[model samples]
Target: MSLLNGLPAHVLLVHVVVVLVPLTALVLVICALWPQGARRLGPALPVLALVTLASVPLTTGAGEWLERHVADDPLVRRHAELGDGMLPWALGLFVLAAGVWLISRRTPAAQAGARSGAVLRVAAAVLSVVVAAGAVVEVYRIGDSGAKAAWHDAYSKTATRPGDGD
Candidate 1:
């Protein structure tokens, strides 16, 4: 039930979101741009999007809980703020993925070649690509801030200076 003996579930869960969201975004962009890929992906893109969207809240909730117990350092505060900004992008990706999937499914196969329907699909695909790109960027931003907050100091201390012991 607890991650590493109550070691803040966010520490563990953040990795999942970090990996899954970007991977999903890449696949989503591919599926959006390529009909063949979309046919192959079927429901996977939407499902992945949903999973990524769900993880946002879980990670943030765990992070929020941990925030109280940890040092009130500016790093942690900034990380929390960056994490909050990710939710909307994640939700947007989910909605876009769902819309693309629904549009693909509802549009009759026979009519998929029709001019207007084709245009609609193309438009949806473009939107999905844009939203997925945003989600990817947001994830990177969140992760980078978190890494800086968590490891910058530790890593800096370990780096050997040019004139050390000289």
Candidate 2:
């Protein structure tokens, strides 16, 4: 888990987390806000959420391993802290997605035109919006910090073309 194809595993696993988290969050919002979307896409949401949630641990574990090997720096420490915080957000998204799917799956007989069913759906929708927003923002923050940690001082202020020796 520490390395992949001779590169740090975090470099690869992070892509999975960065892509899936936002994609799954968008799907959750769509399924929550639109009934047609829910009916059409709800069945797959829980699985997507589960996959997204699962990636967080792998990415973070690999990140933690990478962190241990790299020199100590404040930027890296900040990025690692933000990366660790992603677990709870991912877990919340999964729980909300699963709940929404379950709610969508209730048969008419089971729902029985219950007021509580409608109430729960509304609640789930609200929570989905909040959680999705938070997750996206957190992902952005983590990515920005990670970029700073990895590339902040690795580049020159001005670019030079090939054979531009001075």
Candidate 3:
């Protein structure tokens, strides 16, 4: 898993984490807040969350491997530190998503009354929103750090060809 097609695997796997984590978070929030959305997407929410959660480790592991192979720099080290924190957020999102899905799937006869169901849904919705927000922000921070690490000195202000004026 260290390399893929002669490129660091992190280069490929990070994209999956980048896309799916936010996508799952958005879907979890939507399904939590809207009953119609819950009804339509509840069954799939857990699956999506699971997939997103799974991607985090694969990405970070590949990132760790790449980090070891590359020259050590403070920016890259910072990015790696931030990247290590993603798993917990992803796990929280998955747990909340699964909880929301289970709540959404409750049968009418299985509940005490509509009032209690609404209360549970609202509570779950609030928690989901909070967790989703945290997850998204963490992703942004990790991505920003990673971008800086990758491109901090990759180019100058002026664009130049390989042999311009050389």
Model 3 lDDT at residue 90 = 99
| Model 1 clashing-pair count | 0
Highest TM-score: give the candidate number.
Answer: 2
TM-score between candidate 3 and the true structure: 0.91
Ranking by TM-score: 2, 3, 1
The residue-level lDDT of candidate 2 at 118 comes to: 82
Name the runs in model 1 displaced over 4 angstroms.
1-4, 106-109, 155-166
lDDT on C-alpha atoms for all candidate structures: 0.81, 0.92, 0.91
| Superposition TM-score, candidate 2 onto the true structure | 0.93
RMSD of each: 3.4, 2.5, 2.9
Sort by lDDT, best first.
Answer: 2, 3, 1
- Best-performing candidate as measured by lDDT: 2
Q: Per-candidate TM vs. native? A: 0.85, 0.93, 0.91
The regions of model 2 sitting more than 4 angstroms off are: 108-112, 162-166
**Native-to-model Cα distance after best TM-score fit, residue 129 in candidate 1, in Å:** 2.0
